[model samples]
Target: MGVFTFTDEHTSSVPPVRLFKALIVDSHKLIPKLWPQAIKNIDILQGNGGPGTIKQINFVEGSQLGKMKNCVDELNEETFVYKHTMIDLKEKFEFIAYEVKFEPTPDEGSKNKMTSMYYTKGNVELKEEDIEAGKERALGMYKVAEAYLLQNPDAYA
Candidate 1:
């Protein structure tokens, strides 16, 4: 198995706490409602919303979409950092451990940094193109969520 890591950052106009509450805390419910084409649903397999929680995400229709099982490894509410391990993947190319950090800027907003580390095995190898594509997809989802929150600020509350 070969391990590879990818990092990307994005800035949000919303506050860190608000972003965290909407995106990380309530994503399982909000994502499907907002972007149904990208994410079909998220099922909590174990725990609640804290550490050790296991979640399975189902992709939307079309293409070779697959499910991903992840376990929340670490969660620091105060620091706004969360880490998860991808325990199962539908295919050979999948993320292994994904760590995301939300840093609140002094300017009143927040910056999101996502680091995805993965291993390629069983006739599959990680590629730069695949990593870039994944980054784009992630950013697109975040952008969609951001827009949805801007329009429906009370949806998560």
Candidate 2:
């Protein structure tokens, strides 16, 4: 078992509270609709929209990722912190986890800053390049959601 960790941060024009609501709260229903080209559905398999919930994200037909499961480890709406453990999507990536913190940061008059910490357990020795693919996927998803909110100001307002 090889363990590796890294963090990636994104800045957006959206406010922290609004972004948190849209990303953590409304994502279950909104993500699939917003990114139908990549994600087909997000189904909550267990628990409420809180800690201990197990959710599955189904990818669009013919994608490399057919489906992926995640366990909500922690969610704090007040502090805008979210942590989830990802089930193995592909055989090589055995266990992947994330702790994401959303905080208001000063940046060109925007209140959006997202810090994502990722932990991955690989089946064999992992290189930095091996991890970029997963990080790109996460970034892609976040950007899509952010774009949706940018276009619809009233959404999750």
Per-residue alpha-carbon lDDT of candidate 1 for residues 58-148, written as tens digits (9 for 90 to 100)? 8887735567788989877778888988886656655578788888888877899999988877668777777877787678778888887
Candidate 1 matches the true fold with a TM-score of 0.87
lDDT (0 to 1) per candidate: 0.79, 0.78
Q: In angstroms, give how far residue 74 of model 2 lies from its true place.
A: 0.4
TM-score of each: 0.87, 0.87
What is the Cα-based TM-score of model 2?
A: 0.87
What does the lDDT read for residue 2 in candidate 2?
56
Best by lDDT: 1
lDDT agreement of model 1 with the native:
0.79
- How accurate locally is residue 31 in candidate 1, as Cα lDDT from 0 to 100? 78
